[model samples]
Each structure stands twice: as structure tokens, then as C-alpha cells.
Target: METQIAFAFDSAQVANRFLNALKSSGIDNLKAKLFRGSEKVIVSYCYEDKGFDQTAATLDDLASRYDGCEISIR
Candidate 1:
């Protein structure tokens, strides 16, 4: 049961900040892979979850922690 969360941030700094927060939260089986576009930073992570509810909760938690940071989950 691997879950993936992809985040779009305004800049690399925001991406790094999000990464740090995710790491600090002690989330298990979490992976953040980065992609660079012309004007945006993409971060994708894979986690183990049985349902999207748990994953959404985690995503929301990070979104709240980051405040202005933009995030997406799938």
C-alpha cells in the first residue's frame, strides 16, 4: 500500500522547507523526490497507507504547518 503525494511550491526554498517539516514530523516510509519545471518546483513522495483518508490527513497537516505553501496529493 504505497501512497504518493506531489507538491507544487513557489520556489526551491519552499520545497526545502516542506521537506524539512515532513522529515521533522517523523513520517514513516516517506520519500520526497524533486522535479524542476520552468517556474515551479515539484515534490513527490511515496508512503504506505491503506486508504487516502490517512494520507489526506498527513497532507493537510503539512499544508497547515507550511501555511502558504501549495500542496497536492494523489
Candidate 2:
């Protein structure tokens, strides 16, 4: 299954850093490209049966790295 991930930051500064991280590192083997919204970064991830677990771990790491960033997965 494919999971939808949403990342919203408190400021553009934080958002930029998050974007840079996403660009610099590969988020596992996600097949989708990340696109930025006016205030958030959104991407779709498909990882068979481990979608939610990997998504959660990824979000947790990102949230810990960037204090002002908010993340949601579906």
C-alpha cells in the first residue's frame, strides 16, 4: 500500500532545512518525488507491508531533528 505523508513547518526557514535534508538523503527507497506546497512538503511512499512503520520512523527522526516541523501520515 501507499502512504501519504505531510510535513508542515512553523516557518519557511525550518521548511527549507527539511527540504534540504530530504533532497540530500534518500528516504529509504521511496518511489515518489516530494513536492512542496505553500506551507508543507508532501510525498507518497509505498513499501509493501511496512509502509506505516517506516513512515512513522522517518517522521519521528525528522520531527526530532526539526522542532517546528509537523508531520502526518495516512
Candidate 3:
């Protein structure tokens, strides 16, 4: 039951921060594909069952920390 998670950020810096957090969170088999554009950062990951909960929490924290940064979990 792997879930697809995508988080789009407002900037590369925020994206980097989020990537760091994800890495530090100990989620195995994670990947940060393309960090394109100065205003958009897209990160995608495959999780083994109900991992969206963790991703959502982290995204919420990121949103709170960085103002104007949009985090989309889908």
C-alpha cells in the first residue's frame, strides 16, 4: 500500500529545507526528483502504507515555519 506524496513549495530554499526535513525524518526509499524553477519545488515520494500522515504533519510544520510557502499534499 504505497502512497504517492507531492509537496510543491514557493521557492527552492523552502524546498531544500523540506527535503532536509524529509531526509532527517527517516523515511526510507524517498526521492527528491527535480527542484525546478526559482518559484517552484516539487518533491515526490513513495511510502509503504499510511505514510501520508507523516508527510502531512511535516508539510504543516514547513508551512508554519515558512510564510507564503504553499505545501500541497496529494
Candidate 4:
């Protein structure tokens, strides 16, 4: 399965930090990209069912850490 996440930030630095954090969270098969024009970061992951709950928990931690940014999942 695939999960996609997108969030916008007011500054590029913050966006980059968020992207890095996701990468370091130990979530498997994750990929991330940033769109400069929109100051948005998009992340996607494809993996088996085992890591889904952990991924969601990691995301929740990130949401708290980057409280100033806007995040959405699809």
C-alpha cells in the first residue's frame, strides 16, 4: 500500500527540517520531495502492513514538533 503526506510551511528551512525528520524516523520505504514554489513538502511510502501504525505514530510526533506548519494526508 501507499500513503502520501503533504504539508506547507512558511519557510524553506522549516520544510527541510520536516523532510529530514521524516527520513530519520525509521519508517521503511519512505520517499520525500519538496516543491520550492509552494514551500511544500510531500512524502510517500510503500510498505507492507506491519509498519503502518508506527508510521502514523511517527507522524503524530512530527505534527507536534512542527506545530506551526500545516499538514494533510491522502
The best candidate by lDDT is 4
Per-candidate clashes, comma-separated? 0, 0, 0, 0
lDDT of 4 by residue, 36-70 (tens): 44467776776457644566556656845875344
Query: Distance (Å) between predicted and true CA of 13, model 4?
Result: 1.0
TM-score of each: 0.60, 0.61, 0.48, 0.68
Model 2 is weakest, by summed lDDT over 10 consecutive residues, at 29-38
Tens-digit per-residue lDDT, 1-74, candidate 2? 67666767766677677767766656765533334654566656675673346664675577558763446543
Clashes of 4: 0
Query: Of models 1 and 3, which has the larger TM-score?
Result: 1
**lDDT of residue 16 for candidate 4:** 79
Candidate 1 per-residue lDDT, tens place, 1-74, comes to 45554566666677677777777777665666564542233434454454544654776667556553444542
TM-score of 2: 0.61
Model 2 ranges with Cα > 4 A deviation: 31-37, 50-52, 69-74
lDDT string, candidate 3, 1-74, tens digits: 44444555667786667667766766566665434444444545554463335764565565457543444543
Evaluate residue 13 in candidate 4 and report its C-alpha lDDT on the 0 to 100 scale: 82
Alpha-carbon deviation at 10 in model 4, angstroms: 2.2
The per-model lDDT (C-alpha) reads 0.57, 0.61, 0.55, 0.70
